[model samples]
Target: MAKQSSNRATQVIEAVGSFLRRCIGSILSAGPIPKHIAFIMDGNRRYAKKQNLEEGAGHRFGYSTLMNMLKYCYELDVKYVTIYAFSIENFKRRPEEVQSTMQLIQEKIEGLIEKESIVNRYGVRVHFIGNLKLLSKPVQLAAERAMNATWHNSKAVLSICIAYTSTDEIVNAVEESCKEKQKGNEKLLDEIGEGPLIDVADVEKHMYMAVAPDPDIIIRTSGETRLSNFLLWQSARSLLYSPGVLWPEIGFWHLVRAVLDFQKNYAYTEKKSKES
Candidate 1:
C-alpha cells in the first residue's frame, strides 16, 4: 500500500509539472523563438566537488541535465542545439582522468542511438563536430556510429563539439581554403581574380561548424562570461547568458530564463547577425 501511494504521489507531481511547463511554453511562443542555441557546459567538476560525490559523478549528473535541456529545447521548437563537450586543450589533463571521461562519453554516446533514446524520439540528427581524428579510436568509432545512425533524422540538430576549439577550427578552415586555391580550382581563381586571397565564403565552407547556423544565444553556466575559445568566430552577434548555477544544477527555469533574455535582445542580436 505504501509503495502504491508513493507512486501515485510521484505521478501527480509529474503531471502538475508538465502542465506548468506547457503553460510557460505557450507564453514563450508569443514572442520570437530563437532558431539556435549553444551551451558551454562548464562546472561539472565543481558540481561534483560541491556535492561531495565521486570523481565522475558530476559529469554523470551533468549529462542528465543535458538530456532534460534537450527535451525542453525540442519542445520549444528550437531547431538547433550545440554543446561544447570537449576541447583539444583538455587532452593535457592527467591520463587517468582523461581516460575515465572518455569512457563515460563513449558509453553515453552508444546509448543515444538506442531505439528508444531521445535522439530518435525527437528526430534529432547527431553531429560530431571538430577534429575527430584527435580522439581515441574507440571513442571516434562510437561517435561515427552515432552520427551514421542518426543522419536520417531531420526534425532537429544536436552538434557535439569534441576535440574542438574555435581557433583550431579557424586555422583548419584557412588551411583547407588555401589548399583549394593551390589546386588551381577554376572557380576559386575566378572569385579571387589573380591573387591568392581567399574570401569569407571560401574559408567558411571548410569550417567544422558549417553544419548549422550561428547560434542566437550562448548560455555558459557557473557565471562565466568569457567564450573560452568556444565558437569565437560564429558568436559575433550571439547573446551571452551567464547564470551562477553550476551545469548539473541547471534546470528548466534556467533555459526559460535564457530564452526570455534572448527574446529581450532579439532586435539587437538579429541586426548584428545580419551585419556579420
Candidate 2:
C-alpha cells in the first residue's frame, strides 16, 4: 500500500512539473523568439560517473534529453537548431567508445527516417552539417538518407554537427572556394584579377552552415565557459548561456531559464550589434 502511494505521488509531481513548463513556454512565445539556437551538450560522461552507470549510459540518457529539447524548441517556434553531436577531437577517444557513439548516431538517424517520426510530424527539415567524409560510410549513408527524407519540411530546421571542428570547416571552405575560382570565367576575371578573387564573400558562400543564419543564443551545458571550437564564426554575436548541469540532466526548466535569460537581454544585445 505504501509503495503504491509513493509511486502515485511521484507521478503527480512529474505531471505538475510538465504542466508548469508548458505554461512558462507559452509565455515565452509572446516575445521575439530566437531564430537560431546552438547547443553544446557536455558532461555526459560525468553524469554517468555520478550515477555509477555503464560508461555509455549517460550518452544514451542525453539522447532522450536532446529529443525532448528539440520538441520544446520547435514548440517555441524556434526556426533553426544546431547541435554539436561529435567533434573532430572526439576521435582521439578509445576506439570502442568512438564506435559506440557512431552506432548510436546511426540508430537515431534511422529513427528519423520512420514515416511517422518527429521529423515528419513536426515538419522539421534535417541537415547534417560537417565534414561527413570522416564518418563511417554506413553512417554517412544514413545521414544522407535522413536529410533527403526530410528535405521538404519547412516548419523548422535541425542541423547536427558531427565529425566537425571550426578550424577544419574554415579550411574546407577555403579549399572549395579555390576550386570554384579555378573553374571561373577567365575573361570575366581579367578586368580585376589575374587570378579569381577569393574574399570573405567567397568563403561565406562555401561555409557548411551557409544554409542558416548565425545563432542568436548558444547554450553550453555542464557550466563550460569556453566555446571549445563549436560554431566559431557563426557565434560572433550570440549570447552564451552555460548551465551547471550535465547533458543527461537538462530538462524543461533549464531550457526555460535559458530562453528567459535571452529574452531579458535581447534588446541590449541587438542594440550593441547595430552600434558596432
Candidate 3:
C-alpha cells in the first residue's frame, strides 16, 4: 500500500513538473526569433539503451519529439526548419538497425501524405537534401511525393538531410557549377585562362539550398558540440546551440530556451556600402 502511494505521488509530481515547464515556455519573453533553424537530432540509440527499450522504440519516440518541435516552431513563426535525419557514414551501422531506420523513414513519409497533418495544415514545403539515389526506390519516391505535395506552400519550409555529408554536398555543387559553365560558354575557359578559379557565389548558386537563406541558428541535441559535417556551405555564419538533452527527451521548453539565448546574443550590423 505504501509503495503504491509513493508511485502515485511520483506520477503527480511529474505531471505537475511538465505543466509548469509548458506554462513557463509559453510565457517566456517575446524576442527576435530565428528565421531559419537547423537541428542535429542525436542519441536515439543511447536513449534506448539507457531505458532498456528496443532501438525501434527509441526512434519512434524521437519522431514524436520532432513532431512536437515542429509544432512549436510553427507557433513561433520560424520560417525554415532543417533536420539532419541520416548521414552517409551511418550506413555502416548494423544491417538490422539500418533497415529499421529506413522503415521508419518510409512510415513517416507515408503518414505525412495522409489526412490533414501539421505539414499539410501549416502549408510547410518539404525538401530532401542528400544523395537520394543511395536510398531505396520507395524512400526516394516518397521523398519526391512529399516535395511535390507541399510545393505550393509558402508559410514555412522543412528540409531533411538523409545520406548526406557536407563534403559530398560541396563537391556535388561544384560539379554542377562546372557543368553549367561549360554549357553556357564553350570558349569561356580560354577567355578566362583560369586555373580552377571558382567564386563563392558560383558555388552557392549550385548548392541544394540555393533557394533558401542560410540558417540563423543550428541546434544539436544530446550534448554534441560539433557540426558533424552538416550544412557545410550554409552554416558559416550560423549561431550554434548545443543542448545536453537527448533528441527524444527535448521538449518545447528547451526550444524556447534556445531561441531566448539566441535573441540575447544576436547582432545585426549594416554593411558600410549599404549604409551609404
Candidate 4:
C-alpha cells in the first residue's frame, strides 16, 4: 500500500511539472523570440569528474542535452542555431583526447544520414562551418554528407562550428577575397575602381557564417565569462547570457530563463544593432 501511494504521488508531481512547463512555454510564445541563438557548450569534463564518469561519457551526455535544447529553441520559433562544436585550438590536446572527440563528432555527423535522424525530424539544415581541410578525411566526408542530406530543409538551420576559430575564419575570408580580386582584375593592388579596396563588407561576405544573421544571444555554459574566440565578429549587438549550469545539466527552464531575459532586453539589442 505504501509503495502504491508513492507511485501515485510521483505521477501527480510529474503531471504538474509537465503542465507548468507547457504553461510557461505558451506564455512566452507571444513574446519576442530570438532568431539566432549560439551556444558555447562547456564543462563536459568537469561534469564527468563530478559525476565519477569517464571523460568521453560526459561529452556524450552533453550531446543529448544539446539536442533537447535545440528542440526547445525550435518550438519557440528560433530560425538559426549555432554551436561551437570544436575549435581549431582543440587539436593541441593530447592525441587520445583529440581522437576521441573527433570520433564522437564523426559518429554524430554520420548518424544524421539515417532515415529518422534528428536533422530530418526537425527539418534542420545543418551547416558545418569551419576549416574543413584541417579535419580528418573521414570526418570531412561525414560532415559533407550530413550537410548534403539536410540541404533541402528550410524550416531551420543548425550550424556546427567544427575545427573552427574566429581568427582563422577572418584570415581565410581576407585571403579568399584578395585572391578573388586579384584573379578577376589580374592585379595585386588592393583597390578596385569605385571602392576603397577591402572593407568590412568585403571581409564579412567571405566569412564562414555569412549565410546566417548575427546571433541575438550568445550563451556560454559552466559559468564561463569569455567569448573564447567564438563568433567574435558577429556578436557585436548580442546579449550575453551565462548560466552557472554545466552543459549536460542544462534544462528547458534554463532556456526559458534566457528567452525571458532576451524579451526584457530585446528593445535595447534592436536599438544597438541599428546604430551599429
| lDDT per model vs. reference | 0.94, 0.90, 0.84, 0.90
Model 1 stretches astray by more than 4 angstroms: 184-196, 274-276
Could you tell me the TM-score of candidate 4?
A: 0.90
In angstroms, the error of model 4 at 213 is 0.5
TM-scores for all predictions:
0.94, 0.90, 0.86, 0.90
lDDT of 2: 0.90
Go through the candidates in order and give the clash count of each.
0, 0, 0, 0
Put the candidates in TM-score order, highest first. 1, 4, 2, 3
| True-structure lDDT of candidate 1 | 0.94
User: For residues 25-111, could you state the per-residue lDDT of candidate 2 as single tens digits?
Assistant: 788988878999999999999999999999889899999989889988887788999999999999999999999999999998999
- lDDT (10s digit) by residue, model 3, range 75-153: 7788899999999999999989899899999889877766588888778989998889999999999999988888988
Better of 3 and 4 by lDDT: 4
- Candidates by lDDT, descending order: 1, 4, 2, 3
Q: Identify the candidate with maximal TM-score.
A: 1
Q: Of the candidates shown, which would achieve the greatest lDDT relative to the real structure?
A: 1
Q: How do the residues 69-124 of candidate 4 rate in per-residue lDDT, one tens digit apiece?
A: 88788877889999999999999999999999999999988887798877788899
Which residue pairs of candidate 3 clash?
A: none
RMSD of 4: 3.3
Better of 2 and 3 by TM-score: 2
